[model samples]
Target: MLYKFFVKYLKPYKKIVFIAPIFMLTEVIVDLFQPFLIQQIIDKGLGAGNINYVIRIGFFMCILSLIGILAGLSTIYLSSKISQNFGGYLREDTFKKIMSLSFKNLDHQSPSNLIIRLTNDVTQVQNLILMSFRILVRAPLLLVGSFFMAFFTAKSLSPIIVILVIVITVVLYIIVHKSTPFFTNSQKALDRLNTVLNENFTGIRAVKAFVREDYEINKFDKKNENLYSSSTKASLATALIMPFLMLCVNFGIVASLYFGGQFVIGGTLAVGQIVAFINYLLQILVSLLISGMLLMNVSRAIVSVKRIIEIHDMQPDITYKTETVDNIKGDVTFDHVYFKYSDNDEYILKDINFDAKAGETVGIIGLTGSGKSTLADLIPRLYDTTKGKVLIDNKDVKEYSEKSLRSQISIVLQKAILFAGKLNTNIRYGNQSASDIEVEEAAETAQAKEFIDKFPEKYEKFISQKGSNLSGGQRQRVSIARGLVGEPKILILDDSTSALDAKSEALVKEALANEHKDTTTFIIAQKISSIKTADKILVIDAGKLISIGTHEELLKSSELYKEIYESQLGKEA
Candidate 1:
């Protein structure tokens, strides 16, 4: 199975692989010729006292050595080229599969697990392919070739060679079988450590604010200790292979010398033939030892390959429908939609219905865990609704191509993620074709221009990873600007203004009113003031739409709205 996988990827670089074996063949022939030459130097040159003949053979040996060196260099160069292209192709394929995954599929996988599959796991498979070309092919060919040469040259000593090969193969099988589980577990333990460290680094501010640094450190220490222990065990197991193989090799040599010496004394074998027979025995044992090492690597590679393949084979739950939508308007309606996370038994969003026409603004307000975000995610098909239809411009979202439907809507999530890039690059992420002037205009509208202009590089200033250098409000404003850059027909701002102060929030609101008058916007927020001026407010409670109307209408009729308003505004009435 592993060999077939390499052949498939390497098929494209067939010319390289084709050239590689010819090099190996030359190297092997040179290797085989060396032992015979040693016998010739002993029997014909040194024993007979012929200087010119010895000189000629010695010169030919030099030529053979040069040929071997050139062949080895060419083999390594070609193998490296194949390995690099093969590794790149596999990593690219895995990444594309990850990009195609839906939120449902992503939720089921850990970030650390995914990272391992991408980096460590892919590297393991890559190393195997590279080594297979350099060492795997060479070792097996050398072993079999040496065994056949040993028998052809001297049949009497062949039984000893066969016995030693059998013993070494059996010993290697036992060691690898016992060590396989340790190698597999080591990969899992490393993933655990990665997960803990990733979470800690991401939440360092929270940990420090809560004065839980020691606690977090201890938690990390525990995970680190587990990784350390697993690695020690795996290393110890792998360490056993070399020493055991070396011992077996020594025993094979002693056995060959003891038995072959008798043939020499009886005149049944020439002194040179006995030496040649001993050299063959050593060659056979060396090949077996090399085969053992390759098997160990192949075992680990199998586990790593399976890890990578797991992600490759995953079928996304929310794949694109075959149908396509050429034109999609701003009309959106949720009809009796119900949803729950795959791991959860209870629905996060129960049966719900609502609509927002073109050029209308809808405000969703509720207490925490009211399923507000889940409701908003339905329109974009981020997660499939369990029980109902979410329509876009009167057609079910599933009926349209996912790309076409998503392209028309822009969502500024509550988290407000930003990548490491220039300020303009981040803003223009929603539409890469957006000009610098367009990006600056969106930034001004989001109330981000004043702060952005203070930077020395202005629009070209680098935003650190996830915008860590920027304040929370600044990050939120930049995220809002990105969404606005798309000029989306439908925009969903999920508490996007929560990080800004009241004054900046008002300025952003005014900008939205002036710039996006024709667009349908859904504003989700906790502060009553944020949605007080909205055209329609939907009061949601536990995944259900409790009431929908203007702000004043809801304040008069909805008790939930009244409670939320009084809590935030501190007004009893």
Candidate 2:
């Protein structure tokens, strides 16, 4: 999976990945020459009692050191370039993919996990690229080069080299296999920790209101402990690699000295030969240790690659067309609509049929979880109906392009979400090209201008994250203003006035009726007063639309409607 992902994403930087290794090989070659040069200095210069020869060879070694330094620097530069570009491109693609996914697809994916993949996971892959250009490329080259050079130079020492290599190889394979699964578990632990944090911050207000600080702390500590344990276990598993390899390296050193000393005493090897043999042995063992570290990194990188692959393979559930429908007038119709979250789930909306003409106020009133919001959601195609059609402008909603359909319909969701920006910027979000006058008009229409004008900065006042700086009603009004700024043909207010006082709600309703008379509207509300004056009111019970008529007519005909009215209006009805 890592190989495939790298090939697909790093195609642009493959040349750099390839070239960096060439420089690494150059460094390795230069390193391999060092032991031989030392051997030459000891045998020819020192043994012959020639100071000039010592000076000449020592200077030549310095020149080789310079070349090696240059090669190492070049490899570092190229590696950094490849890794950063590779990571940058992958992050960009992941963000774009997240944006393109349908709401249904997003429901299954955790935001915390997605964030980890974009940041920590991609960073791990970037590290793999860096290691590839550095130790990954150089280690094997130095290991092989030193071993063969030692073999050809001292055939008698071959058994020592072969045995040490075999022992280290077996040890590395076992350690890496044991540690690979731990890396995957640790990544999951990180996701869980981030999830706890996200929930805490987003609902910090609720936590404070209920005084559940200790409960939240306990939750965080539990997740944090799991993350700690998982990370420590992974670290322990890989930590074994370094010591085991070092022990094997020491064993090789002992074998080299014992065997080579005997050979020198027997006159079969010179002192320089034994010394050079030891040098080569050290190089081989050191390279093996570096190779072990690289394998540990590969294990972690493989886990991240698998995670990223999961996201890359996801296809959006709702497909949209690029072809726009002409004159989208927002004439919405639900024709025998049936909807369920999935095939196995019960229908949230069942056998529903209704129509709202191009310029009328349609009110949907129901109890909690009675499908008022879900039914309203169909008008903008947030979720497609499972067994029927939702039509816009008399055309199936799916027939219009996403931009053409959604851009014409504005929905201020039940939550009244506001972003961290100036008031003007928030309002202009619906239509970026809306002029200052248009923005002010929209705010006035939503009754948001009253409070906004009180801010010292007025429209330029900086709103905090999620509008935490504002009151609930203020946030709701800001959201309504944002929706109205685009002058959408269809506007759906899903319990948007629930936060406002009765007077404030009345003012907003009066402004909407006067300013947006030609806009088709849907009001999904729990309070009867909110929708009492709507042109047509639809009464819903369970998942079915039970009655549809004017307010006075429904009070007379529907027991359910009359029950709701009597319960709320309290005999004043």
Candidate 3:
């Protein structure tokens, strides 16, 4: 699975991946030739007392060293380019997949988990690719080349090289195997820490209000401790590989010197030959040590690959057909709709049935946890019903392309989310092609123009992240203007006016009725006064539709309606 994913994203950079290894091999070959050249300069030039031969061979060695340096540099350059590009592609595609997911799909995963996968996990895989093209390919080839050359140079001492190689390989394998699970655990710990941090940062105001600083600190400490322990375990395991490898290499070096000294005294090997053999032994050991370190990265990358692939494997719960539909007239119907977050969970909305004509205003009022927002979410197919169907303009919403269905509907969430950009850009999010006049008119209708005009830069004024620079009512009004700018046929406001004063709310409502009379609107509110003037009001209780009627009719007929009206209106009622 990991290989297939790499092949898909890295296909465009195949030439670089291929070319990088060729340069690495060139560098390795050049390194291997150095010991042999030194052997010739020592035996043929120094021992034979030939000054010209030593100088000639020494000059050639310098040229080869330069060539090796060039090859190494080229290898590093190409490997980094390929790896960075592959990481960029992988991160972008994973984020796009997350954006395409349905609300139900997002419910199963946390945003922090996705953020870690896209950034940290992608980086792990990228480092592996970079190492593969550099040390990973070079180390094994150098080890093998040194072994063969050691045998060819002095067959008698080759057995020592063979034994130490086998021992180091076995020990490194065990260390890597024992550490793989710890690395996986470490990554999970990091995810948990990120989740906790994200929540704390987003809700810092609430934490301060509730005086829960110590509680939050304790929570973060727990996650931090888990991450610290897991990382220490993985790091300590990997740290052992180098010291053990060096111990074995040092023993091999001592043994080679002892044996090679005997062979040199016996006249079977010359002084130069012994020197060359020890050099080859060191080369083999060094390559193995480098390879052992790279294996740790490879193990971590394998875990990261699995994490990333898990997201790509998910099939979104909501999918649209290829068929396109014309602009809908905002006529929405929910037929026997039932919704549960998951199969094992209890239903949030049960057997819900309702209809709204084009240009009609429907008010939904219910207590918290009564699935008011869930029913509003159904019209845009944010989540598909567990049973029955949602229809827009007399056709099943699932039959229309997602673009076609979403283009006609605009929803202003209870929490008005705004990005960091100019006021114009935030408002233009609803309709990028809207004219300046259209933008002004929408803001005016949303009752936001007055406050916006107070700013020095007016429409071009910059907004902070989540609109932190604006007051709560100002943010909500701007969000409403954004929804209105698109001129969507259906506009759903889920408690969007709760922050506004009665006068502002009334003015906003009056503007909507006068300017957007052809557009259907669903206003979900907790206050009776907010929706009392609606053409039709639907009352929900614990996920069931308790009553559907005009405000006067519901007040007269429904007990729940009268109780809520009296709670808020009292003697005025």
Candidate 4:
């Protein structure tokens, strides 16, 4: 998975990837030659008192250092360029895939988790890519070069290098393996903590209204503590790597000195060889330290790659039938339909059957959670039925592509949603090309014009995020105006007017009746009065079609309908 992600993203920057390593190779070669030059100075120039030779070799070393610095800088620049561009593409594709996913697939994913995957997880992969071109490439090449050079310099003390490599490799393996699980848990804990933050901020009004500050604080602290604990555990595991590597260094140096002194006294080793061999050993230690740290990071990056791959692999895009429909005239039907949410065992809508012709106003009355909104969703193909079919204009809903179907059907959910922008822009969201007069007409129909006219800027007034600056009724009116602006063939208002007073609700309904006479309308309401005057009223109970008739007929023919009416109207009924 990691290899595939690298190749896929880096393919566009293959030239950069190739060139980066060349510079890194140049840097590593310069680093290896430095120890050899020092040995030459110590043994040939300094030992023989040839000041000119020492000065010449020292100048050559400085030139090599400059070349190494230039090469390192070049490598850094190329690596950063490739990694950042690669990260951009990775994040873009991941976001596109998420946007294309079916609502069913989205229902299973948390907003917080998706946010982390797009930001933090992509960053992890990019960091690994950046280091791969620099530390990763340099470490192995320098390690091998230093090992060969050191072995030749003083073959008798080669045991230190071999033993040090073996021990550090084993220690690094244990450390990285132990830390991987902790790092995964840390990422999950971060998701939970972020989720708490999102909920708290989004529902801060409710929390403050209910005086739940202490409750929210305690909840946040618990999740925050989980994140801290998991991160600490992972950090501790990787932290041991440096100290263990330094210990190996101390051992290798002590052994090198003891063996070199004996070999020197016996006339087998020179003082210059001892100094050069120690320098090479230090280089190997540095390489190993870099390798160990990179390995741990690679483990974490692998987790992120797997997450991105999972999203790519999901059979998530909503499918369309081979047959196509050019237009929707809002003739909707549910034929023996059964509906259930993804991963749910019980159905929310069962064996449902209904019909609504174009230009008819259908009021759906039901107990809360009795599938009123779910039924409306089927008309727009927000979800596919589990059994039987949802047909529109005498064809299966799947016959129309997602865009074609949803464009013709506008649903104003029970909860009003608004973006941060000018009030006109919020209404124009339903139809970006809508004219100014059309936008004003929509606002008037939704009973939003009266309050909007009071603002100095009127339609151009800035709306806060989620319309937090607007009251509940004002927000609902604005959302209704947005949905109505497009003048869709089918309109589903799922208790969208619940926030408005009875008079405002009646005015909005009357305006809809007059202005959108040709549009099929579905009104899902809690109050019996809200739907009592509908041309057709469908009583739903426990996900079944309990009764279907107009208000007067239902009162006489349906006991459940009469009971609901009496409960609401009391003496008036």
lDDT string for model 3 (1-573, tens) is 777998997799888878888999999999899999889988999999999999999999999999999999999999999899989998998998999888988998998999999999999999998898888999999999999988988889999998999999999899999999999999999999999999999999999999999999999999999999999999999899888988988898898889989998898987777778889999999999999899999999999999999989988888888867678888889899999888899999999888999999999998889999999998988988899898988898888898887888999988999999999889999999999999999999999999999999999999999999999999999999999999999999999998998899999999999999989999999998888888899999999998999999998999999899989886334
Candidate closer to the true structure by TM-score (higher is better), 1 or 3? 3
Distance from true location, Cα of 449 in model 2, Å: 0.9
Worst 10 residues of 4 by lDDT: 317-326
**Cα lDDT of model 1 by residue, 1-573, tens digit:** 556666778889998888898898888778777777777777788779988878988999999999998988888888888888888999998999999999989988889889888888888888887887788878877788878877876677888888878888888898889888878988898899999988988998899999999998899899888888887887787788788878877887787678778877877766666667678777777777777777778778889998887887789888677756556668888888888886456888888888889878899999899988888888788989999899888888888787687778899998989999898999999898998889999999999999999999999999999999999999999999999998888999999999999899999999999998988899999888888888899898988899999989998999999888888776322
For lDDT, the strongest prediction is: 3
TM-scores, all candidates, are 0.96, 0.97, 0.98, 0.97
Which candidate order results from sorting by TM-score in descending order? 3, 2, 4, 1
Best candidate (score: TM-score): 3
Query: For residue 135, what is the lDDT in candidate 3?
Result: 89
Which 10 residues in a row give candidate 1 its minimum summed lDDT?
Answer: 564-573
lDDT, candidate 4, residue 336?
98
- After superposition, which runs of candidate 4 have C-alpha atoms over 4 Å from their true positions? 321-325, 570-573
Winner on lDDT (3 vs 4): 3
Question: What overall lDDT goes with each candidate model?
Answer: 0.85, 0.89, 0.92, 0.91
Q: Which clashing pairs does model 1 show?
A: none
Candidate 1 regions off by >4 Å?
1-7, 322-325, 571-573
The true-versus-predicted C-alpha distance at residue 494 of model 4, in Å, is 0.6
lDDT of 2 by residue, 217-291 (tens): 999999999989988988998889888877877887888889888988998877777778888999999999999
- Clash numbers, per candidate: 0, 0, 0, 0
Looking at candidate 3, the ten consecutive residues that score lowest on lDDT are 564-573
Residue 386, candidate 2: C-alpha displacement in angstroms: 0.9
Error of 3 at 412 (Å): 0.3
